[model samples]
Target chain A: MTRLAVAGVGAISPAGVGVSTLAEATTLGRCVAAGPISETNVAVLKKIRRSAAITLYAATAVEEALRDCGVSGFADCALISGVTNGALNFSADFHHTLVTEAKETASPTLFSESVLNAPAGNASIIFNIRGPVYSIIGGQSIAIKALMLAATLIETRRAQRAIVVCAEERNELSSFCYSRFNPKAARVFSEGAGALLIEPVDERRPINPVELCTITGYAAYTIPGSPHLALQRAIDGALSMADLEAADIGVAVSDYKTATLFREIPTLSFSDCLGYAFCVSTMWNIILAAMACGGGCPVNPLFAAGLKKYAKHSEINHVIIYAAEEDGDASAIILSRVGASS
Target chain B: MGIITSHGVGVEANWEKIKAGESSVGEITTFDASPYRGRLGAEIRCDTSAPVSHLRAGRLDRASHLLICAVREALGVAGLIKPGIDVFLSLGTTLGGMLSGEAFHREVIEKGISRARISKTLDYLAHYQAVNLFKEFALTGDYTVFSDACASSANAIGHAFGLIASGRYDVAIAGGYDTMSEFTFAGFNSLMAITPEICRPFDKNRTGLVLGEGVGILILEELDHAMRRNARVYCEITGYGVASDAYHMTSPDPDGKGAANAMAMALKDSGFPDIGYINAHGTATKYNDLMEARAITKVFSSGNNGGVDIPVSSIKPMIGHLLGAAGAVEAILSIMALVEGWLPPNINYVTPDPDCNLNIVTVGREAKIRALLSNSFGFGGSNAALIFGECR
Candidate 1:
């Protein structure tokens, strides 16, 4: 098991303002969702209205992540994020207000956030991480990919610790996007973010050690034939990472988007509790797996799949999370739970 | 990477025809440029006859088609593919598929622009023309679409290089693509960046730029990966340097200090004091050409040409300005020059500016070129320079 640790977290989601608010809401199964409202012209009002979009969710999550890490500065750390649609969620009302509200002498710092990498930029500014900041937008598999990247950062020893954040904000416009494609399903549009503070576990440091969940294995593939093939590959790859088999295990977290649910077999239990979350579903699954480990829930491996419409069933000694996009790109990461007493 | 020239779609076909020095610029076919000042532009030949398989797959957005054609050719030439290869697809594009959105908007406007029409248009905000390209490839890798105006793709390539060099990803596909959109065409027309006739870079009587569109992709891998896999190496990306002017959005720094700084940084990063050839970002604008020439002179001048006397050329006369895609395309051209040992001519260098005195490769010439540098400076004072040399 890799000795990677989640050192800190920050978040902004529909459930409320910060990570604490989101965690409290999640405990009650409260989703930050509202009926679609008519588009508004008030920029601030629009931000208030559609602020559930992943971009804003990501922004809030980023701020919280920095704060939770006690990172008052990004002066030395590299900033990297998994952004699915970037600032595309920011409405024209926001831009218009930004353009109109700027007096002749606009503050230089105001529009700096307008950059697509603003989430990382803001985090960098807040934390004073003067190193490198990177932002990449993969479809729904962005979160898993981010975790993979964070691991790579640790493996390379670029920094002792790095911040890896995955967030999606609610956008009123996204409804049209979903309606055009998956019209039958109730819009599972929820704006939320999940941020993890990742660091190397150092036995030398005299600090309260966070319980570690090791990332065992991961794989990503884009197939034109069977979208399900992606999930199968991830399952096989993740299991082999630990040199384990399908029956060795415990619980699972599946980050499969619901849009692809109709295309799969009806065995997974997600239909009962976790409906569909495009990207956040991955984090949701991880949260569930963590909960299962905490409450001694029966070990049922989470099987997540996307548009590739494939199912991945893993039997592991520890919890595992599966994440995939609809169009055939899928990734599976095995997490080894530590500290059974906890 | 992929090459989308008017003569043909793939590399072999383009190489066969480019030797003739044929001007691919002609009348605009995608849209009516009749009322426009610069009616001439480059267009890619689409092979619709080949059936595109896969559900919701074959429908290629204008930008996507260009990307597919180009990437396929590049991959074929590279002669290798691997699973578990993390990809960073970086592209610089603007107003992608907005032409389609405009078509949708026009129908609504004809019926009278209503609240419904307004919402529909705003929704297009999320559907940038480039996303269609990503969907077409089914690329599940981490990616980013940069919209830094003109110098967008250059920044994309530069950033991709940084990511790879910094050990973020072992392999990456970085490039740029832009199709002429009515929105961009009209906007540039309004801004007076479009020249009436052929663009004359660095010429005394040079006018503005002519707009063109195509896709360019560079399949970049870590140096070790290419060697181990025995992938055909076109050129090694030696140095990439980026700087912001914070000077102006539309205009470049007139003093050329920012441009000079970027080139110096690139050369310094490459650790190469000697530069062989340059693919100048000579857009032929009155100020751009003069400014770029001054910048080049300051960096390359050993005493006369500054300090380093090197041959320089701009292929914009052949392809016109591809805007967001220019950096990637120019970088491709630079790599090709290193590999092919031939310098493409500047084409329309009938007269030269007294202020710009470097050896412009006006005529296609053969040379033992190894290391080359290319420049792409975009709006908002964003400047990027990339140096590629024969893979050592």
Candidate 2:
């Protein structure tokens, strides 16, 4: 088994650019409203806006993440981007153009960006990452899938390090479809990007115990017609891999309501503060879990109350991240502090 | 392995057509392509009137149709469709259901957004295809969708290979599928990457690539797992490697560094001193062929077999470029050649360019190959190489 470490992190949520900003906002229990992205801090690529907002957001987050890590060269890094809508803006634009204008007159740039892999490709170009690049498409569970792939890549030695980025952009078509599918759950939809740099854990180097998190195990399952069952199965699979029980988990982060499964475990949710960001939701939760383990709190007030109760019993060591999409796809990941493994 | 291509459906049908050196590229009849500069493409002939009994009626796109047909054939061959067996599915595609999405968009525009069925909009999602497979087959296993431009399926296979080889999954269904759509066609045409004539890869007079669509499915099982099940292993996937040029979005590096690195990585992973054949990512474009040729020369110029010439051929001419599915399709053909003792010729190779100075196989030749390598480089400089060999 290969032990992996989270080297650096970055985020481009509604709150702002850096992970610190997101953590600060989350600690205050502030919910940032979705709006147009600010370009002031981002290093815009040429004609990047012509692509999808997902791609732009991913590029921004990746740049910030790399900068935060103080790693310059990416020749050996692999990029695994988890996406839900992919290029929703481009898809909508292309469709709008095709519907209103002739097929021949549709913008090729929009069509190019409309493909599911456009954001990964654009990020690869921006970062000069030559190692294997893959775009894993799914619902909210995609972020966990990306983490699993990153761990696999590192474990297999296919890549020295992997940059896993999950991003989703709000658009009319997706918003409309979500509203039509589930009205009550529609208001939580938001748009953002989160990036994490993961690599094989090196014991030789001096590492911060707080910043250090090991991806013990991950699991994904598809259960038709019952997302709750799928989530349970994934959690079970992950727990088996980590050789831990639900009671041993210090913090459980998820977009879905996990009170039924992880009853006594302290649960935290970023969607409460960040809203539901599709693919970005689970990743945001993961960043917060890492911060919390590193002695930082980004939980909402209600979740913070639960965290306070758990904090008295034990120091934050193990964090379990779970996410299930409406499509019945579910994924779970277990992250534990380096020296705090049970 | 199971395959559905423009030449026809099934592995044998496509193999026969490719062996005959026949070009499947023709006028685009799926839709009105007269408005585009390159109107020719290789399209699978599916009767829309007859629906697949298992799949949802009226909502299946051409890509999904091809995928379902291919998966059924593959599972039938593998005999792994029975319940209680856990499978990890990794599918690769550039556009999942753009055809259906396009239709939905047209309907929404003509009728109204409110009139547009939510099911139709859901069909537009890339993962919707995987979801359909999960429900249709009752696959209670992990699944992932890979969309890395033209290298999509190749990367999918690579990832799947890793999953199995790492003992993560006992079995996996890895392949790629894509449909030729007006959206993709117009985009390629605008980029001037589509050839008006049949694509002549590596030929001196080659212009550009011709669009094609199909699906290729490979049922991967661990050696011990297959042996225990008495499964007939067609070929062993020894190694796979993926890399990016980091050069440009749509163009390959002039030095072919990324392509060469991928091949090198695969070779190292395979622990094979030399490979007998290379299925080139020969799009027949000006830059791809040149870069791929250079990459090949860099890797195999000084072979361990004492300067032996490795046979190389591009099946893109016969099948056109399948885009996202091209990698898996070409990889299947390469494995077929390794098993059948013949080289798939590069048809339409009238003249050779000096830039591509390798030993290009213009005519089919008989050869007992031990190992073969297949290359696929896609838009955004994504490059992948897969190695397959006779099962030891």
Per-model C-alpha lDDT, please? Answer: 0.60, 0.82
Cα lDDT, model 1, residue A244:
59
lDDT of the structure predicted as candidate 1: 0.60
Give the CAPRI rating of model 1: incorrect
The candidate 1 chain A region of ten consecutive residues with least summed lDDT is A299-308
lDDT of 1 by residue, B1-392 (tens): 88775656766566555545566777888776777667777766556222233323333455655666687677677765455565766776644444445544454434643333443342243223334444555554555556555566776787778778876677778888777665555556645677888877777778878777777788888889889988777778888765544454456778787678778778887897457889999888887887788888888786943533688888787777887788988788777778889887877788877788778887888888778899987654556788998877
C-alpha lDDT of residue B356 in model 1? 84
lDDT of 2 by residue, A188-272 (tens): 6777789988887773135332364778878998877678898899999998898888787877888786569887787777676
DockQ of each: 0.08, 0.72
**Residue A171 C-alpha lDDT in model 2:** 76
TM for candidate 2 is 0.96
**Tens digits of lDDT, candidate 1, A1-342:** 346655555544444555445445444444445322222123223332323344445555555555555545443344556665444434223333323443223322223333344455444433445343445455566577667656664564444566666655545544555665567766566545666666665621334233434455665554533457677776676678667565444544564544442333332323223334455556545544443333333222222221123324232236657766555667776666543211
Model 2 per-residue lDDT at A269: 74
- What total of clashing residue pairs does each candidate reach? 38, 0
